[model samples]
Target: MSRLDARFQIDYPGFRFDVACTVPLEGTTAVFGSSGSGKTTLLRCIAGLTRASSGFLQFDEAVWQDDASGIFLPVDRRRVGVVFQEARLFPHLTVTQNLKYGMKRSAPSPRRIEFDHVSALLQLEPLFQRRVSHLSGGEQQRVAMGRALLTNPQLLLMDEPLASLDRQRKKEIIPFLQRLNQEFRIPVLYVSHDLHEILQLANHMVLLKEGRVVATGPIQDVFARLDLPELVESNVVGAILETRIAEHEPHFGLTRVEFLGQSLFLPQQALPPGAPLRVQILSRDVSLAVGAPLATSSVLNALEATIAEVSESPGDPYAVEVKLDVGCPLLAMITRKSFHQLRLRPGQKVHASFKAVALN
Candidate 1:
């Protein structure tokens, strides 16, 4: 199996970075953390742009670095393509020229991505003749991505490529990123602090904190951890569920999705039946009940669940996290007042319900 594995130990005057993780060389892998958390440092190390004094880095069967043996591959020697926060296109060149500049760097081997293929993949055909300065932020980023893909790289390193874009622009470019990930099947190491981006694009995740690896695994498994929201210092607490469209209820503007051994009703989606989708449900959106709530309630999902674990919520002195085993683990955030009133405890049975709209 193809994989990117690395273990690094870097020391500074007052800080030290100790990290080790492995990510599959397929689909996108997100390196997530807040600023000053060494996310970029880790990306640089993987790309061979920054050397780890004591480390081992390997891609599939090729070793990029091994300190014990005094081996380290330089950036140019590694078949890696990097995209930064900003689209560093040449101001004087047209989009076509910039893309060609990237293609020129290719070592002339049989290429998997061609100019026409990338142009179509990124929808860049019409923007080819336009100067880089004239395009929108989203357009420029798309071109940057197209340029990177033109290289036919073994690995792609993107460091917050959407950070410079506004909300609208980020929204505009996401589908293109998704398309590229699916079309090229390139191994990508994407770095970002934005949980939204990771939830949408990442299949595997590596969570970092203060220059250390906190967790690394499938995105759904990592996100479902009861302590993750506190560890990342963000309220992006949620569960990622991979489900299929089982049926549509047009009269009610609802869609039925099946997962594990149960089904859920969500806002109507235009997708055909049997289409796979990944849904995210925030913990705050879920409410717990000692018994089944009335059918008259607006909640559409009320599944029977057993308490897996209960823990105090950090930063919120009045709230607690309740992990529920409803076929799959689901997290619910409840106030201390409610917890005490309901007499909730571990190993107890309860009902987990949330509105259909909460299934995003």
Candidate 2:
């Protein structure tokens, strides 16, 4: 698999931005951080929009920037498609014309995306003849994405492309973004401070903290790490499990997914059996028991797990975080009072339970 290697350092009067990491060139890799964490700054360094004081960047075998060799590719020469917070479309031009402008500037020989295909992918045919000025916020963003895809870029850089939209608009645009990754197989560097967005869209993550790299790896691994104080303090720490639909229990109005021989139940899904599914299990939603509870309980999932680790929850001193291994890693947040009562320790056997309704 190809990867993007980048190292950059920039200094200003009161702030400095420094980052070094290599992320795989597949699916979506989210550049995640709070404000002033250099999320966008790092993205600009990769996009060639902001030149770093000292930097070296390479995409797969191609070196886009290297200070040692004095090689720096300009924005246009890099062949990267960028989508910003705003659509930045030409109000005077119709949507079709705007999309064609991107197609015209694309590299001709290796052109992989055509205008019609992009139009269909983004469902932009309805607004093609309409001026971008009259489109809704969500519709305008769809046009912006179509234009970017039409450029036939080797990589796509998005800086909070959904930040300006309302909840409904964000919902409307997320499916299109997922399609871009699934169907087109375009490597995307999506910059966003929203954890919800990262969880929904990113396969890998580059976590930043005050202009420094805090963590970078597959989303599941990164989230499971206990050393990252930044994540622990965020109070949203959890585990992401990749599973496949096993079967649907129509009578119970539930769907079953299997992961490493363990099963989890969720609300009924319209997707067919054998379809891929990614489920987010927050630590707060899980409970640990010394032994398997009776089947008479209302909770649906209760898997036998072995205690892996225990640590204080950074956000709440009174609480403790427990890591468990049930075919795969799982996390549970419980009060310190219960921690002492159970005397939980590593390598001990336990059962992890959570209500099926807790999963979405």
Candidate 3:
């Protein structure tokens, strides 16, 4: 069953976020757009903190809003849990105490979440007695996540939850977030403008432009159809793939992931087989050759594909986007110099390859 049925419109000074969309009742749905693009505002509306001018909001068949009947639930009354950009844990409260607040509120909840499950999923056992103020930025965020889970909500909303942290902190928290999604089977509505995070975390994308939804679909199809890459940001160029951890190789310090029939040796942390994973491969990092080359190079992940289409890229070094068919389309950004070097043209057979570290 679909997890969410929602729509809303909000007016701000010279800005309007009139969004109408449907999200899966499972997995993470990303509300992705640039800053001041109404990502946060949309999340607020869902939480019942920001009232919509007129719309409908439902969670798993429960009606939170229906303008026709003027049905509106207060923020506190709605069975929704929200974790904001800032880890707003009570400074005076210990981690355990802060977590307890949400659990106690859910005591009367008809569908309450177990404390042990929440603690285990978020790795909160080690910091149970530590004061909120004493924890690092990442640890505090972990605690905040635990608090939200303890609420036992039907849906989860996250508004740029990792925005306030540095790169290291973001890395530390993402794994936990993914674990929460799988462990609890909670539907998440995540809002963000960071493409890397979006590619890594979300399975569904709701592309917003000027406060209106421009496209929505499985991320791959949406990207293939999206012509305006400028709407996003620089360094926001890549594609996502579903990969599974394969058996390990002791000789080489690399982890293999089954990409299709081929096993891609990626510079990822090793894991056991059958573990499902997602990987991001950057477009710029991809290099193209006219045919499979017998070269002496460490670069791996070579795929045979035909150039289906090409487009002009904006930069000092002129570039073009090449479409490759490894079942799905793969994007490669090649310089004008190299394009002329290979005498590359459309409908030409070519090989695309890149380094393992470039996978990120």
Candidate 4:
């Protein structure tokens, strides 16, 4: 396993931050939290742009930082690439030139990423001859990502890469980001405050609060933690499912997905059989029933589940969050009245139903 282990101690006038965690160094590992949570600071620390007063960081066999040994690699000495909120492309250069600039920085080696692969992965072929000023916000960002990839770094750091884009622009760029994870076998450290974006791209997560690492694990398991709502923003609390395309019902405009011995029908997707998919189910979209849902119901999915925990919803006195183990943990939000009426308690068997549209 390619793993990243880190411990940090940073101090300022009034604040002291202490954190430690180990995460797999593959796929997208999101650094998630709200404002002032030190998400960016952690990213900078990993990139060697910011030094933690007392820290240790290791990726597989390479030691990036170890304060105890007085070893601290500077940014230039590290094989890391960073993409900020802005594209930061050179306005006077053509897209080709900008990408070439990134390639120029890397030491010559057989492992260096080829320009063609980066171009195709990011869909930058058409923009190669265009000036940086001529591309749309999304296009520019795609170019920026391509440039980063061409650096052939061991790890890529993205600090809210989509923050500057509008909703439509974000939508336009998500596929490319997905490709970066699914198609290219590159390790990424994605920093973002937007839970929606994290849900869409991250496989694992590191949650921070006041510069401290509160939780770190597979995205699904981390989201299932009963203490999450109390530790971070509660509204984003939800579940993730790793599923495969089972079949498609073209006539009904829906597709079937199999997850943990259960099947769910979602809005039609053209993916072929066995294509892997990751879907998010918001806690608010889930409801609990004492028995299996009837066929007449509009809800497309319901599965046997057992209550794992019951906790108060952050800032919502009238409702409580229920954690259910449906193969994987599924979170549900229900009114206090319903909680009492159902007599819900841990280990109770019930059915969890959710509309397929709730799967994002």
Best by TM-score: 2
Go through the candidates in order and give each one's C-alpha lDDT.
0.87, 0.86, 0.78, 0.87
lDDT of 4 by residue, 86-161 (tens): 9999998899999888689787767768889889888889998888898999999999998988888889999999
Give per-model TM-scores: 0.93, 0.96, 0.89, 0.94
Model 1 C-alpha RMSD vs. true structure (Å) is 2.1
What is the alpha-carbon lDDT of model 2 when measured against the actual structure? 0.86
Predictions: Cα RMSD each: 2.1, 1.7, 2.7, 1.9
Instruction: Mark the regions of model 4 whose C-alpha exceeds 4 Å error after superposition.
Output: 357-360
User: Looking at candidate 1, what is the lDDT of residue 329?
Assistant: 80
Off by over 4 Å in 1: 108-111, 356-360
In the range 1-360, model 1's lDDT, one tens digit per residue, is 699999998997788999999999999999999998999999999888888879999899999899999999999888888888899988988899899886888777665788898899889999988888899988998899888888889999999999999998898888788878888889899999998898888999999999899989988778779878867887655577778999999999989988776788888888899987777778888899897678788777877899999989887999988888887788888898999999999999998887533222
**Regions of model 2 farther than 4 Å from truth:** 356-360
* Alpha carbon deviation, residue 211, candidate 2 (Å): 0.7
lDDT of predicted model 1: 0.87
**Looking at candidate 2, what is the lDDT of residue 255?**
92
lDDT at residue 232 of model 1 (Cα atoms): 89
